[model samples]
Target: MNRTQFLRLCALGAALAVGGPAALAQTYPSKPIRLVVPWPAGGGADAVGRAVAEALRVQLGQSVVVDNIAGAGGNIGTQQFIRQPADGYTLLLATSSTNSANPYLYKRTGFDPVKDFTPVASLAVIPSVMIVAAGAPYKSPADIVQAAKATPGKLSYGSGGVGNSAHLAGELFKSIAGIDVIHVPYKGSSPALTDVMGGQLDYMLDTGAYGQLKGGKVRAVAVASATRHPLLPGVPTFEELGIKGMQMNAWYGLAAPAGTPAAIVERLNGAVQAAFQAGDLGKRLTDVGAELRPGTAASFAAFWNAELQRYAGLVKLTGATLD
Candidate 1:
């Protein structure tokens, strides 16, 4: 071959060499994938994570395992996932607590929520319900608001922990409704709701933890969303009561450590999105008071960032700080 022909052939070979691995990475999950659930077993996040993993196993033709790494308000497991090689083999179950709220709540977090992770896709969003104990004096939302206004800090709301979604939801209610209610933090939502039922806590903001309401333990006052939830048909949304812009939905998404290959990220996102639309996963999520929210990586990044800013402002407005 002539010199020019040889030079062109060499260029073509180099292009193929660079593009080959990119194409291979696109066919990711050639083996089992590890999905980390940062919460303890049997809660909403754990249940949802296992369902998604099972659906993904079918989609990817490989075993998808859910490893529960609970503690430190989900930061422990999340930080461990970030320590993994960003190769899509390892993923973290991202939640409102893990992604947006806890970073500001803790004095020092091991990983930068926005910086250390790349969004895969949002899995689902769990709506918080305004619930009061069955025997509480406040039979209506108006009654609770009026009582709060009248007593200021005397009325209280219990939450899972400091800076949890439930905690933020309570603060949001106080800000828009112009009430002063004391926020009591508990170790978890179960205990928080426990006290609410026992009359120790006046009310609480909680997610649909099942049995909490189905067993006639508490009365749902309102849903903290734009529309009323089907599970609690009788409950009204804050928006319907003329409380506009009072939207707070705790969400869960999927994320891989930063520096993961773009092709791998796309593959994982596709698998998750497909699983969400598969057989009973979406229905199950909805049944548990969560809506399936599927979106691309860029979309999730934008969503998460906006939530961070919004919550930061709300935290400031509530004058809530943890140290």
Candidate 2:
């Protein structure tokens, strides 16, 4: 062919290449979408993932299924999710532990939280409350701090496991309160909370303690947030109690494998934002103690990056390590 014909053919090829991703993004969710929760079925992450999946199913007119892949402090599921195709079909219901804390906690997490995933949208932030048994002697956060100070290493706190958010929060609290509280790691929160109620432990931090507090099983001494949680309005914040550097929030967000089409990521983010704006998902999450945080992909990425740095510093300061 002549030079003019060759140039025209090259231009056509370029147009097809440029339009291919946009075309694919427009028809995204033509099949079912997998929402992977890197935790057990009954945990906070699983609940959030299921709720978001259902809302997305309704909003996107496609089936969004939640797949629980639990192990290795959420590293196993996260690794598995990151290995999937970057087609926007498989999504990870990422948490602070998986995306922020795990890398610093474990020596070999096998995935880079910042680089291995594409941020879709931030779903919510769940702040932990420092809880003690309802009948315990500690009536407030100050009481706990004073007791720990009076009897260093006598007051023990329970957590889901080493290097988990609860553990980190407890460490931060100890550091800020200038007390010596022993850390007791459990396989999961239920057992830890159970021990706390049984008086086997002095205190514990949890995001899902509202029901327990209402049922008179546990009492919240303080919330590890800047402000009081709506569910536990009577509970004071650590900062309010004059304890600085103890504010921590466990957040959840949606992410796809790295290199996913930006158009697809934006579409998913829009769906999540729409779901939150519709009020049902927001109410459901809030009822479970999650603070709604709907935002764009870019915003979520910035937030995620900031969280990584924050958790890294916390981990280093706390000297928390899983391996």
Candidate 3:
């Protein structure tokens, strides 16, 4: 071949060998990255999402912005999220409610939990607490159970919305404890928690309420975990209260849309690991009743898949559904 032809062939060969634009691109997150939180602002998941965005900002040297696309028990936001470009610029601040539990609870979740997203990192897990207004008659887990059994549907609990973690937790509590408490769904947890504190609702089970617990407005009846949380040292676990098969912990993780380059996914996972290792992200999340659960991309994927299966059974047991 001639000299010009030889150079052109060489360039073509290099381009072909390097594969697509995702493989050729060296700079990732060239612009501000969007972290989609399917829950409304001021909720527990939003807080976690904001924290992660800040961490990513420092680690990735790009502004990681939190976009609250809340509604429909996370289905609306997830639907919108899956439509974003899979270029690693747009990501998801995933939660158990959105990723695992909602599919089982809702008729159509808008996106397939496994096929529509790529797992980046497993960030943390927040244990749910069974909470009651401080001035309410019930003081302990047994007291709440007795009251529910006695009054049946008279006593009620509130949750942020149907198919939310709080709702799922309440369902599990009712099923395992054998109570007939009414479940009142609200627009968000803050309002639901407000009703709980005001005595409008008998109780609420969620990872939120840490702030209220400190102010003594709401009292924790029992943690849903098998062991007591360090943040809630005085609180007793349901297992401690002799209520077995009741463990509800909402998990948080990062994910990109499906078909995002694996290299980009790996890089994002590394940033997450680095963020968890450095910074007060761990402490900040822990302050909100979250325990750090950092892991690799593969590990996070496995955990995500397992959680999907577990929540499927849990949702089935609760008989909670939403559309």
- Highest TM-score: give the candidate number: 3
- Give lDDT tens digits, candidate 3, residues 1-323: 99998997787568647765544344576689999998888888888998889988998899988998888888888899999999899999888888998888777889988999999899999999989898988878789888888888999899888888899999888888888988999877888999999999999998888878888999998898878999889889988878888899889999999999887888898888888788578877988889899889999999999999998888899988762
* C-alpha TM-scores of all predictions: 0.84, 0.89, 0.92
Q: Single out the weakest 10-residue window by summed lDDT for candidate 3.
A: 20-29
Report the Cα lDDT for residue 122, model 2: 92
The per-residue C-alpha lDDT of model 2 at residue 274 equals 89
Pitting candidate 1 against candidate 2, the one with the higher lDDT is: 2
Candidate 2, position 210, lDDT: 67
Per-candidate clash tally: 0, 0, 0
Q: On residues 56-164, what C-alpha lDDT tens digit does candidate 1 reach at each position?
A: 7887888989998877778888889999998788988888876788877787879987889988888888888888898998876789999888888899898766777
CA lDDT of 206 in candidate 1? Answer: 76
Candidate 1 lDDT score relative to the true structure: 0.80
lDDT of 2 by residue, 1-323 (tens): 99998997787567658788675566777789999888777666777888999989988999998998877878888989989999888999989987899888888888987789998999999999999998999988889888998898898998776667788888888877778889988655667888999999999988766668889999888888888998888888988887887787789999999999888998899898889889888988987799989888999999999999988888989777663
Q: Give the TM-score of candidate 3.
A: 0.92
Model 2 is weakest, by summed lDDT over 10 consecutive residues, at: 21-30
